[model samples]
Target chain A: MTWDILNIIGTIAFAISGAFIAREVNYDLLGGYVLGFTTAFGGGLVRNLLIEIPIELIWSQDYLFGIAFLGITIAFFMPDNWIGHLKKWVIFFDAIGLAAFAIQGADYAVSIQAPLIAVIVAAVMTGAGGGLIRDVFAGRKPMIFHSEIYALWAAFAGFMIGLDLMRGPYATLFLLIVIVIFRMISVHFKWNLPHKK
Target chain B: MTWDILNIIGTIAFAISGAFIAREVNYDLLGGYVLGFTTAFGGGLVRNLLIEIPIELIWSQDYLFGIAFLGITIAFFMPDNWIGHLKKWVIFFDAIGLAAFAIQGADYAVSIQAPLIAVIVAAVMTGAGGGLIRDVFAGRKPMIFHSEIYALWAAFAGFMIGLDLMRGPYATLFLLIVIVIFRMISVHFKWNLPHKK
Candidate 1:
């Protein structure tokens, strides 16, 4: 039940984020819906593909799709001033979504008995892949590739899960909180990966 | 045996194409290799995922990967003037690759008893998805979405295969030739899909 709740929250948050980006790019309504749907589910879809899970699993989540659509529709209709005010909150929710999805992805990989590297990859991809795809579609460099320490936190969670250091709902919840805090701190500090000048 | 040969030809052509694009974008050798590999196999990867085929099928093609690497390496070492002179040949090989992959993808989908729409999607994606992914990684809009009538030929091929109008190796070869000629003609004539001004 807890996992389901977290998944729903993450889906709605990603849907709104995608809708906002579509609006920024001046995409039509259909584009907005497509982007919104992709953001909400693209990560999981990629993860499932990598893990060789049935693609039908994605189609089975009908309710989640409805929730994502609802979230995007609401975002589409919101006033500009309201969106401006919600920017910070959107970031906060995005962090929550990232954390939840990372943990869930790691858990799924671990359950499947995937190798440690695969587990970590599943986590990072599930956490950041949607945003990467979204940015690519919007004709921008993927933020995860150049921005603050984002996917690294997801990697950390995956490592812990792969090593069997984290298990159970409480432990998972604790890790999720830690990752969210670390991600937010990195954002606030403007931390970045090293690159050649 | 024929399918395997066609697959190899397509893979090498795509790898060279990808390496050229990576060079155009000023990516390093490593980037060239990555892009080349993606452009060679990303379409099949996506097609398999959509068709629920085991992802391991991609990894099993060890020889194809080696050929792709070789093709990219050759492209990387070639002088710029040589590349300019070979540009038309590259386009011709690319058309061959597109037709081969499209027919192969549609055949696979039909063999699996997938619906007509799925077969058509499989064809188009297998034909053009690698280039789409390559352009996205290069931080550019997908040319297939806006450029010449590339995927439509793939769709036409797929439709024929799905309806069982084209069967047997001889018929398949004929269709492949037809698609390649149509693609080349489209390029020469500057054919394009309709869009808003």
Candidate 2:
């Protein structure tokens, strides 16, 4: 229930972000749809592959595809001013999507009895992989790799889940909320990972 | 077997291509190594995932990793003049690698009894997917999506194999040789897919 709702919201946010990014980068409509769909689904696709899930299961997620297409289409056709206001909140929406997906990804790994490291990898990859592909296809440096304390928050969520420091559906909900707030705060304060040069 | 030798040659060529591309784009040594390995392995990884191969099996290919590491390391450490000389033949090497991997990828799909479309997709992806990843990581346009008739040749080989217009190991070898020659000629003549500017 909670998980399903969060997943849909995250998918919508990611899809809209992908569409906007594609348009901003001057990609054609086909490019916009491809980027949008990939951004919405790439993470799950990667997670399923890592967990040895049947590939066909990914394509079978009709709701996921439907929501992504709807969101991206709306974003693609929306007027500039309408989008401009939303653009200010793009980072916020992206953070929400990331946090939601990250926790779910970790939970999936834990369900599969994956090791702690694998759980963390799943979390980070699921949270950020779509965005990475989105940026790469747009010819921009991936934000997860280049800036901000992003993947770390996903890792932290996964660690808490894997170590049994957190459990249960409500606990997962709490974790997701905390992660979203934490990500928003990180971006607001310009928190960043240390880097060379 | 003939296929085994061709795979090794293709791996080495792709790895070197990756290392050189990394250098050309001024990536660090670690980046060079990562890009190299990913370019050499990304397509196979994608293919294996589609075919539902165990993820651990990817790690178990000792010789494949060993060869990629050796080829990338050599390319990375080789002096500018040495690399420059090899760079001139990059297109030729890239075409050979593309043909070899395309046939091998199609063969794998056929072995799995994948549908004809899946076989063709496997062939083109296994041939061009690595280069796509390589270019994306290097922040350049993917050559497979543009320029000469690169992916078309890969698809041509896969189409023949999937339709059983070509059969057997010897026939596969013949297909590979013909595809390689065809790709080389296409490059020499600057053949391109029709596209809007």
- Each model's total of backbone clashes: 0, 0
Q: Which has the greatest lDDT?
A: 1
Q: Classify candidate 1 by CAPRI docking class.
A: incorrect
lDDT of 1 by residue, B61-172 (tens): 7678779989998897788889888888888888989999999999989989999999999998899889889888878788899999988998998899999999999999
Clashing pairs in 2: none
Write the residue-wise lDDT of candidate 1 on A104-196 in tens digits: 888888887887766876887788778877877777765665457777888888999989999888999999999989988988899765421
TM-score of 2: 0.61
All candidates' TM-scores? 0.61, 0.61
- Model 2, docking class: incorrect
Candidate 1: residue A183 Cα off by (Å): 1.3
Model 2 DockQ reads: 0.12
Positional deviation of A115 in candidate 2, in angstroms?
Answer: 3.3
- How high is the TM-score of chain B in model 1? 0.97
